[model samples]
Target: MEQRKIPFVIRPRALGNAILVLVIGVLGLVMAHHPMLFSGFRRIQTDLRDTRLIHYLLEHGYLWVCGIPEHRTFWNPPIFYPVSNTAAYSDLLLSVGPVYWLWRAGGASPDLALAGWMISMSAVNYAAALVLFRKGLGFTWLPSASAGFLVAFGAPRVNQISHQQLLPCFYVLMTVFALARLFGGNPQRFWERGGLWLLAVLGGVLQFYSGFYLAWFLMLGIGFAVAAAILLPPCRTVFLEVVQRDLWVILTAGLVGVLLLLPLLNHYLPVARYLARRQYLPMYYAFNPHLWSWFHVGGNHWLWGWTAGREPFRTLGYPPEHLLGFGFITPLAGAAGLYFCRERPICRLAAAVTLSMWLATTFLPGKAIALVASGVAYYCLACLFREFNGPRERAFGLASVLALLVLVSFPNIYLQILTLSALMLCSLELVRTRGRPECQVVPGIALGLFCLKVFSLDVLLIGVCLVAPAAALIAYYWVGRRRDVGLGAVLLVVFFTAVTTILDSPNVYLGALAASSSALLVSAPRRLRPPAWLSVRALIVAMVLVVWFYDQDSLWLSFYNKIPGGIGIRAVGRIVLILLIPAALGLAALVQSLEQKQWTLAAWIVVLVCMLEQGVTTESFDAAANRATIAGVARQVTPGREAFYYRPWPNPGWNTYHLDAMWASLVTGVPTINGYSGYNPPGWDGFFAVDAQSTLDPRDVLAQWERAHGLPPERIQSIGLDRTCEGPQQTRHRP
Candidate 1:
């Protein structure tokens, strides 16, 4: 037998770094070349006004004040008793807590400030991934890091989730990661050494911040965890022992996190009260008393929309894209992941339970998996891949299974062919590696494909197999077996491309920073001059805001119609790009890995998934309008005694293409209604369904609300407007 050395080009660590550079660079380049935020995903951008509120809350210590431009300065209102609305405050916490201080300390620009917030989220998410793989999945550097890729950059759909909602996804996914890792394998690593105690505390703490979504995923994850644990030789002992002994510790973690954070959270209870007072009637959803078909939805509908008079799309199966989702790209690979469940007993049960639930939720006529359960379910299934290796030399056998499944499930020829090819590659690789679950080249590739759904078009995902493998093989030959050198060269090129892109697209990023050495580029503002409309002090303060970072559709009519470009660029295109982040990262890693002469197998999977994400949404420049509205409203408000209304708050709020006047209150720490809080009363969805309405007479609803809460009208007056109005007099306007 000839013992052939295929070569060890890119080692694990270097491969990862290289791929990171490549992915980031690619995005950077795109950012530079076509720099309009609204070019494709106009609605996804932030409203500077709301962002200002985040800064304001951090700086002013919750002394609510409207920076109403009419008054020309921050001022108190005519009303007496203050209304403590918790909803706005809750929204603020989600946006401001993590990056508020950093923004202020750094003296950053709006763009930089926002970018900093995003970076923080990615970092926390990355940490969570580390915990899962290093500690839970028990994989080495490659697989462990892959968890972060899966969470932060893995699935393309993440981009479509509002920037704020990403936090919910982040925290919840973290807890589940701990669940899978802590309880999945090597229980002694955590439970024996206070790991169970750690998990309990982490779970509790995250669950508090994570909200309803955490609860949902917890139900699903626990069941899945139970299955995973049951399969384990040591799970019973660990689960029982940990649950019995460390339950309090875990509970305390949540209690303590909330307890400590509540003071800050309470700082804005008035805002929540404000949210609760209003209603959020959406169009897409309604309790179908007569027909369940009206509620029929695809698996991806974890979003809310302002309903018009139209009956919910009449359907029993998922909407077209959704029905196609399970069959996206490589149905075979997804099927393979599902089929692998049978190879291992516990694996089968967990897979069956999780995937079945995920499938049901996806196809369920409601928002079952929209929160975080869907994401957790997908990843948990990924972990059930113990069958790709071990006693079953069934890589080809299973690969055949996946191919056949894809043929049956998917009806789209382009996607079917593209996905089938990718799956086949993955299937073949599994055979070569003897099904060692550790090899990630194909899955990583698949992960890359999966990520494209966030912001780019799916059709590009097909480019992965073409671009990555070709580039990787070429790099390997040039660099020999040294993964470091190969990846370094590729990384340099990728970074240069990203930097150049950013430089070119002045509208997208500070090209100067990317073009220059990162060391020389500071995220904070270098100057402190009060330039135009802003006061010198305000300028200085704005320059020095401690950054803290980082919604759904509502009422999307307000969103789609109001976009800045007036609806030209493909909204789905934007989604595709952001969604591609994970896959891009993974593919870059693969390419970078091969450049460095490393061995990885699943790069193809990322490629396949990315291909499928393109067809998922209707991308457009609406994202620009959405973000513009957010930023625009922040600049419009002049703090003073003048009353205001978010007449068109959450509808546009959920998917901001352009920042509107509303942002000032939130950023400057003033009170605001109809921000991103879900505190709107129970009948909100129904309200929107009856009419494509943005305005409601606050007078009509106010008395009812105050009476219910046992509060006076003065309290509502002190906060702001009685009802969100779509009139000229409204201070914080949404329309």
Candidate 2:
């Protein structure tokens, strides 16, 4: 076989990579979350929800390791006073164990530790992206560095700085890179790569514990890589070698995660399993594409306001979608990879995983429908086989098995079903029709079922779904038939308008359809003369931009609603981050324009324009924005004391100020009755009911508290003026 010539071949050095990654991290911190480097990093305070909570958990974990027996187990975290295993109420998984200990060893304050972790993780994201592009895709340092910046500091991630746990996604990138290296070609010296494989699995395990949702996301990408490796003949031998060399690493990582999580499982398994079972459907619906567009960019990001004005973007104040934008040239590059890099198995695997993740993450219409259908089918099977006894039922019981699996292992259902169904469909079609056109009917029926299901739930998705595929087909044909540009433009407009008008949202389904269908078009017979080389790339970029634009509104919120002490940061950071997409697109234009020896200065002008726009729009969180100064009240309490709030600010359903009550517990290391989280311990409401209606009766209050917590009077304490008893002790206005 003739060796394929690769472009932009500058080999990256470790020192250069580290320096560039560090630069990206420093820039990320300065531009977005902590602009207080000059003032002092220690003073930077992020908002409550997860940031404060995560810090609290980290502090608790550190104290536990430093010989504080009460903090030994996160279960019954000296919060919500005697509420056992309340740490399970939030995803306080020990994934950040290393970060916690490192900060502890360094004697860093919780705030300082958090800031350091965030900045370092941002750098890790940049490095991982660089690895994926350079080592994985054979790209040179400059383009790879640009791509790294784009991925690591994109709008969605910038907005998630407050939700710190979700920020360290370099594991996903690293895992993808590892897979590329593993199966990119023949495994040269497979035995010697054990260390690399160990690092890969170690990254994966760390990701799994970091955040459950992000771990699942990474698993989805990994699933795609594995499927590609096994299914693609050219990669099969290397894949086997990789498995042979790395099996122990994979098992070791699994064992380590299990050991770390054992305590959590032993304490909260049944309760969590039950709660998840009850909340699964509602939670899924709340976050799914049916209620919200998958293309939703996010409401908190600054660019969201610039792209779509500050009207209420969501129907209700739903949490925004995760993907803000893919940067300008990303989709184009992905499409090009699919079209032009088929010969390289690594490129093919990377392209396939990236494309699939884009579609899946965006909740593309077909993918969503398939997901819903599979979920429905899974439950239906479980229900149908309910009467089967013992182990037999366990084999077919997807829901029950899933719950059990969560208790003992990390299992990703969404990826499993998606990958399995796709492979089955492809295999069946190949077997049944030998690649003939008639095999299309099988997928057509599946598509019909998906459409019917979505239509039943909401006709909007169906319309969007249908229009998206049609739009993709038109764009694909238009690429080959440039003479019919007018016709193609009209069709694109009609499809886009129909979906936008009907659904009142730009959706993922449409974009996914367009991209995948365009892939199919790559192999279609040529019916017309090709256009200018740059035109093809430009056309593809345009088509993808349309899709990217569709979801931008979903990225930022109206920010109209406000609760007591609710913190809302300005959208400047997100807006600046969004500009990175255009900047990257311009860079790509410059690179291409240089290659073509035309329009190079115009490309430079575009790049300059985007940078200028970002400079003007980029904003950082004010010190006061994230500050919750509960330290004055908290430090008054002595260590190992029981604390109670006198009618603590009633937690008005996610009212962030209520979180201040628990901040006292975290700081003082005192178990406090007043605390907050999504899943409160059982009897919490009844306990609150009594606490809220303050009637002066100490014995009654004590009895009620005892019953609520199932703990003795000595085990708890009423700190800072127990209002249940009217006296001078109640005179101190502690919070």
Candidate 3:
């Protein structure tokens, strides 16, 4: 008798696990966000302004373009009436719109559809992450489920509930899973490879349509992954082989991706040209994450809520964007993973020394010079001991010794010869090593110290010390092989420790040099086992550390700000959403290991702690009340007008009314000049000026529109204000 095997069958245990995950996840979500879930979709989560904009976009704006036949074009949304391509001013929600529309078509109100869309997206994100971890990454059920929960409902993401555009992050996990499968192993069949490539491209396209921030982040993540694959010896061959075999497929996919992205680029490029890139002051002070942010849990958390609106957490304004805490259990587990792996002892030591030195330098004064001199001395000695394979090596050693002697002889020549010589030597080392991870660490550290001295920013050595070890640890743990630490790596540890003493940022160039130096310490090849100790677990810890130290208003961030699109990124802090993957995986691995070791109580305790840490309450506003307000304002619009502008009182109290006017336009199928969104239309300031006057003259309002947008006065007129609806603001439900 021949036995036939069935594919895609769910085992009883696996099915039970899946059901359990869903049960717990849904119960947790309902408990945490009860207001949002139980409001019958008559309430919205987060800020009223953004929630309304998102609702309008999903229900009316994008739907109209897709054949609903609204009065406005796809590009020109009703709000910000006269402005062209106003939809491009923010995320268009292209991927999420279809699902919302489905719900709406199935008899759901606009609010209900939006609410359902958010909850469903969260569930989908969880499912995608579960599959990625369980099937793609080959983790067991417990770890996969735990990680999925963190990825979908982590504290950081809960805090960002107002940002409806950021909700559709399932595409990111799907893209990662596809890329991993596509590159991690060889697929004999062409169709299989092609399918993976297509999936990857679609995931990326969907991610871009979902939100630009995540799209940019996905690109960065891919670049990092590719770079790691190339640098790590074991993965390099497979990566190269895949590239060679699938060159045509890769190129075709890229071309298709570009074609798909053209519409988005077309809309965004013009806006990018018109608006000035975000400046340093705004990015650094307002949008950049802080070191404390990663530990700053939201006030909605049951356990950590007490810390909210307090020191450290409340130091930075814009609590929603800044609440990036991944909770205590995740990081502790990550550290435990590193400790259990115990593969890169030297790398871990380097991290510890660097961190200690940074703390020492931060609190202590006048230790920087001594520490720096010691670092230079150690580098010279390491150069002396290093084997001279050729004349270039010998010459470099001689130059290093001479440079140290010169520094010792003339200490006051701070900004001249020594700084230049150190930089030149660092460049020479990079060239000599050809970017071999083991050989580049010492020179990089030396160069960073010299540059810090040159800038007279000895106190800022704290920044260099803090970032250097993190980069080194990440490079070594993720890419380096056993026994790969050489004279350079050894010298780097001492150099980092000594330089740390001087630690304490115009040293943007110094920070970048230091980061590059430390980051270049990739050595040897990663082990080739399925669950290699130093593979995923170590990588997660390293990445979390990188985000912790560099995501803030630090030198690394300053360097990032100089990149072409970097300035345009309003919320670099949002990178936490991506970090949720590694954080969740780390927690899962820890729990899985604990359970395997028969430490059942510990595993349960860890899981409970994570659940509590990730728990959060959401704010919901009365959409029904706002809809009534919109209806009241809609009746005020005159018939047969191309557009009507509403002028609410120029005060914070009347802000909601201004938003209502935009909503009224949607209801009446007429364009309204009143608008609210990410980017203001050109000459919007003039419109505000006109509104501030005591009179409500149509000509004056039309003239202001004409002066700002150059829209023809005959095409638009002003509508009378609805003073009858002037009452207290709508009630909000908070849980």
Candidate 4:
């Protein structure tokens, strides 16, 4: 092998690298204006109505936890209906545990309870992103940075914030990442960096408890692999052959979860069967791809918005697709990895996972489909970890393809620019496709079933997945970094930069970016050097402008327009604390390195632009918009009785406020007319379904609640919500 020169493609000039950091800092600034940050982070309204659901688990008394029925008070669960999912869901498991713990620890204040929920959700989301990026994308700084912003702040799962379902999904994403790391994260390490045997089992148990998707995912694919291995034997060798990596962990974890819930599951067997179903609304779940085009192209955020003013994405610091929590960039650089990656197994796995994710969204019902497909999101991030150190030939092809595809039909010009830039940077490395350990047959099969939309198969896959790891010795053989194969790095840069500039929002930073394009006018001027004074001066000015531009564009000032000095303080503080100005300054300095007409500078500028563009916001939530309108109506809950009535503005026996068996789940630690252990017993809907014509009788209400709920009196508290009754203290909840 002739000793060929390896140009430092990954290591841009010191100035250029500094610019990338600045751009990332600018993104951090953009994040400061996010809806979650300033909108007061209010809890969802539906959650507010079902107070008992949150409180019953607080464990003030043993009788309440046991499900003994109470009267008129909303101390019992609603009757289970075969038509819908009511009693159990993976999303509920993780939340229930945390809420219970928090309340028992004397943190029962509703405000505190809501805060804990949000914090936990945020942590889970971050953890999931970290796992997805580090393990799936091979652990690069950029992937990790982008993963945090992309996964937590991205547009796909907006409902996560609204519904509080994000935490469990985060847990699930983290589990997959951990598994990937253990199996093949480093060919250098045979297992995780530290032994994680006990941890793996615990994770498996949590995965099952958190969401039903994992269970269904496993059943679909893993079952086939095991059957093929046992019945065919021929394919057994094709999968993992190691003895230490077998099915024991998964089985053990699963058994633990089942045993833990055995008591609850058995006692409520009848109710369980009735409630073990879904609403099954196929038509209600339509995913129009055109919606993406509308959302991104309109550049205003929502699909043209119902109010129809200047769209939301247009005014924000970030783009609509990047932040509103909806769809995001299609495969992009990950598409290139399919052909260009040197770690063939990693590439193959990435392909399988990505395909599965795509299928999950297209085929499955409910939101879990998206969660299933995101399995590839982490895999793609892992692939981005590769860096350039070899031949630059085929390195940029996939990136080029992605850029071109986005340019052709991508509605938002900004997206085209960003996509092109992404593709360019992703192609900056030499990639190889070859051997690596950490492969497991179970996750692979589960991923496949996810795409196919076989919900039942998910569970079996987990079982098989746990066992497959046991079959292989699972050795690690990390590949050395490869350099780019024959390719022109500089030319690629200019082409992408020009594209992003043309496509992106016409903002002040862009103009500053354009003016700074002068720096690219002259690259590595070995013969003629521009004065150092000019570069530093331009850099300082650019940093200041970055901060000013962010504050002006954020328009959050508009919300606080009435408040004195809020905007001035927020903007000044943001410049230093937010980090956007620094990132932009860094990027602007790098642009100065390129010479005019030198397309290589174009490449540098374009990539910087892409990274910077990601930080921009589009629309935001209006704080003035009232959230609790629907659930705010007052419903009466007597302190010691089951009877209640509605009273917001003096209700005259109007049914505006209704109570239910499981109402406890929706109130402030007060027993409600709602809940469940098995299936909804019967007449669950009628608890809140009663007409005001009936007289409000405490004894009668307690009897009704007793019949409905499986709880006894002492455990239930008929706490106050509205003035349903005032005269006497009833003890219908007392045994």
Candidate 5:
């Protein structure tokens, strides 16, 4: 491949430009939140306010470092008394601990400290994106900068503001860069000896500290990459070479992160299991992706109203704010990026590997395989003995075998299997039938199966919309290359017929519209007679849309929508806006292709619009008065006094007192029973038992009180029960 010069004027190599990008990101975030930053009002992003758990974490870490005897271990804090190991509740030890200690020591308020730390992390995230794109990919400054901006302030970061785990994403980027060199055979700088292993280890460490969920996500990604290397001969050779050079570094770094997590795991496992038993499976399916949700413009933008209520999308984890995947242009940009990188075998392979890992992580393909295997085993057992006189036993057996094959096939592998199988069968038929027109029948059947496979999982959900564009791509390609049309045309016709049949059944009239639009693009190059690449580019974009459409797994297999009342279709629009990040990347590639100065500026302008309209950091936090009141109340409260909130905790959707308890605890240096955290302490139920009868019946309350105090029933009546756990207003909000 010939080396291409930087397409833009901006010198991406200059240290000053990188610094300027970072500065701009920081200043932009601060300016966006000027209402909270400039004023003395404390800033707490949306997620923090919803849980106030991080506030507790920051305060807990500070006192631990300060050597305050009572605050030494958050486990035995005055709040949530009897429930222990509060420190095990979150991924706070490394990410937020040090930052909180520094800011607290400097006399910043708890809310202010938290806000500052979050802002600072956002800046780091922005800078890291720039480094990954510019340094790792070797893109010119404009495209690299565009990628950086999208990543730093993109949907994932904005949606995960409360998570703290997702904020420190730079380490993950560094790790990816390392892997690119090791497996993708992407070149590294001369001074970068041992950099791959070092980055892998560092990314692991920081990822674990940043958030266990993201750490697991990263590990899964690494596992997939390793698996890919092992499967592909060329990639395997590269992997083996890297492994031989620094096997110990990889092992040691991985072990250190795991060893550090052992203590937290020991405490966290029981609670996780407990919650999993009740909520895991049901919640998992509930959060499945609704097909239409992907195209809806997110609520973050002013233009959201245009597509807001049109689709019913949903999620179980974060709201639409955090669930952003590639937005409306997912079909367009994803295809364009792939087409641009089509010549780079390694880049395509890496993308496929990463995407496969994400699918596996979200869908638990292993479990699906196991379930299918069990079903097949049962069928085989039945077939061996003829136990039941079922209708069409041969047909059942064939279907079962086919289902098993599909179940085990990974995402990209499935695409190859379908495409190759069609080609082989079609070619064999053509030879057997002596080049007769009937040879088309075999490929037609296979193409129909492919279409069926694409939509059978979720009738209209998951990449169903891609059918139109995909058909167009196939048709256009067939038209352009008449020599290959014999079998290809048969496949295209069969595929189109199958897709339109399904769409018509569901009354989805948009299929025809999509096909028409794609056809128009395919014809544009002929009519306008523009650049030679324009028509091909348009076809590629259409092809990408078609490929991506069938490539997606149905919502039934996804983890995001598992929980009951997860972000449902009504609220899923915003999450789809995240697609814009990749779309921006695609625009960069197009600009690079055009090599035009004006188009480059236009790309930057689009990024700026994304920042202004889609930005969420500004709206993440509540006003300063709330923080001030909580602080005031905390100061007046007696130090070392235990406190607990009412029966139920605050909800982001409804409740207003979410941050009150934690904020007061931080200010007063008192521990309280009413605390919100990811992990529910083992003894929480024992300490605050509330069955149906206890909340309403005085006698039941007394009985419960006596059990809690380990006292006789007569003594419970003598003690006033009303004072126990106090009213919500007095307990959570009082000074």
Candidate 6:
């Protein structure tokens, strides 16, 4: 009469708890980023003057497919008239189409429907992460909630609220969870295993329909995980065993996924072929994450707004892609999880080699001597630390390092002695605790030194002070646990400081060093324990680190760009969305492992800091103006008439009249030649240039387009020029 527990199943209470947390989180996010909605739902979250409008039009295309009055076919949206299959010009949005339709059918205004859809997507993302942590990974409520909050509404993600297509990331977590359930365990029943495989495939297909960027990055992340599993010794047997046992299930699921994706591929292949592949220089400049980017939250962030107009951020080509900040707490918590988790030596070695290659490629030649000298000095210090066993010896070593740090950093002789004396006393007091590990003091010392060296007493140092301790504490904890981990952690800090010192800037080198060092420690030999890499914890750490590295324009991305579909992916930074999966898991693991009350308190403080850091200011479009403009255009472009919209002035940008023209077509079921999307039709550039110069009449522009596309003269029925929407416009017909 005992109840049998099911794997990867959420109990009712856990489900309830997750739902409650998700609701609160979603409401908080709405308040922070979309407060205008409370005044009137019509005011959607958008600047109303960016390429984001195209996403709005794309979602509206789904409403057109649902029996809305539209003269054009579903695939050929009314915009970019005469260009067939125009909906395929960007993400299909097929997965969220039904949801949009339902929201509209329930009598929500277009703007309201779009806003509701975005909020719902964010909610779904949160719920999925909660389920993944609580059920799939067996985490308790606090960590699960914390991780779910981070994945769904992290600082960087909050900056991307306008990118609705990127909002619905539930499938990313779902696919990862499915893979974990399918391969990480041995299920006795064939159907259960098959279902998991099917779930993974379904997740992939949904992601493809959601956004091309998400789909491409999801596959890339999966490939990384699978490669790690296969290459690392600990995970190899289990990975191979699953493949050997469930070859049919895996193959069948894959085939099914391909079949589901074929229709989308057919629509997108031509578009991809027509569009020029992204070049290296532009991609590296615009899409690649610079070292400062990892810490650069957007200008609108609540706590970090002041840092927005600073050095590198001002010079970054694409500001959105540079908003890579994941806050200090979550990553440090993740690093802590990595330190505690066991992993394969080969995995660590591979990661180290990869980092070495990156450092070799990017390191400045002039500073090589400095890097070497610092590295050697750090190595010697680490060796000395290893030999110390008592509190006094540890205190003396830490004090000496502090004094040297203070003296070297400050130029004034009196200031140097005073600062050095204060730091020495603090270091002595930090290590004076009997029974407590001296390594625990390392984080405090590191925090003070980093703040003093980097910012002096600047207010911005608050974030750094809060963040540095988490990293130092985590690294110190690793040192306390094992001799090799201690050495690796120390070397990692030294190498990181050396790189920053030599480059005269902070970059992703620290991340690379931490990842490589963690990997090395994971691979270190363990007695009687299974390979740490085989554990769920190790998988989470490895996947997070790999995704982080790949997002920073690693060599893997360069290799990926050579393959089909890879060259088309310009926004490589978007791949950071995948990090939410491992980040959530890592956070949950860190919270669960905290046994001391003080550590628990520190964790909470870190969480609060993260929330403030992630908080964003919302922007809303003037929905009334947009609605009036579209309606005015719709009145001018009647049924049975394809409109040609031309601006006498040079076309300012895609978001201006072009957006209105597209909206008019969607509303009136009229096709318009003016359109904006990821790519233009074959002859759009030349036609647009000629029209923008005002050399050709509106009719001449339509005629030029028709002639280029080999269309009949009768195809152009009306011309919607600059003032056409205000009054009567003459019908243009070619003789």
lDDT computed for candidate 5:
0.49
Instruction: Write model 5 residue lDDT over 1-735, tens digit each, in one string.
Output: 999897767665687766756665775566434546665554456544443665566677678778787677744544454456655555554654676678878998766777777777667766766666666665676666656666666544555455554566666676766765555553455335456666667776676666665555566456666776776665667678767766776676667767776765676565555554444454434444344433333455343434443435333233443244434443354456656765554544555564553343232334344333332232232231121223233233324334544564434332333233333333434444544555444334543454555435454333334454665576677776443544444445444444544443332223223322333344344343333233223323322322333434443243334533221222222322223333444544544543454665755555455455434433555646666657644554554343333232222221233246556666655544455555455444432343323345333543454457454433211111243443323323223
Candidate 1 residue-wise lDDT, 533-624, digit = tens: 22222222211111100022222222333432212111211222222222222333332343244434454454334333322222223434
Local distance difference test, each candidate: 0.36, 0.48, 0.63, 0.34, 0.49, 0.60
How do all the candidates rank in terms of lDDT, highest first? Answer: 3, 6, 5, 2, 1, 4
Query: For model 2, how does the per-residue alpha-carbon lDDT over 1-735 read when each residue is reduced to its tens digit?
Result: 999888975556867866765665566556555454655763553455656677666677777778686687756677667666777666554666576578668987666676777777777777777677677655555456555666676555665556666677776666656655655533467453554565566666666556555655455446666876786677777788767866776677567656765765565465655464333333333343322232234433343434333333354223443334433334344345344545656555555554444443333344344344444333333232222222233232323322332343212333333223322332333344433545344433443332232223344455456556666677677776542443334334334433443354233334334333443244233332132232233333332233333323222121112211111112112222322322343344334434355654753454333222221122234334344446644644555545544232232233343455577666666666766664666555544455445564434554576776566655455443444444223223222
What shift in Å separates residue 370 of candidate 3 from its native position after superposition? 14
Give each prediction's root-mean-square deviation over alpha carbons: 27.9, 17.1, 13.4, 23.8, 15.1, 17.2
Which segments of candidate 1 are over 4 A away from where they belong?
A: 1-82, 88-96, 123-127, 140-147, 154-156, 184-192, 227-327, 341-346, 359-642, 645-661, 664-676, 681-735
Say which candidate scores most in lDDT.
3
Report the number of the highest-TM-score candidate: 3
Give the clashing residue pairs of candidate 6, or none.
291-507, 342-532, 343-532, 343-533, 344-523, 345-523, 348-519
Query: What is the lDDT for 38 in model 4?
Result: 45
Better of 1 and 2 by TM-score: 2
Candidate 5's TM-score reads 0.61
**Which one wins by lDDT: 4 or 6?**
6
Tell me the deviation in Å of residue 501 in model 4. 67
Instruction: Judge candidate 4 at residue 495 and give its lDDT.
Output: 35
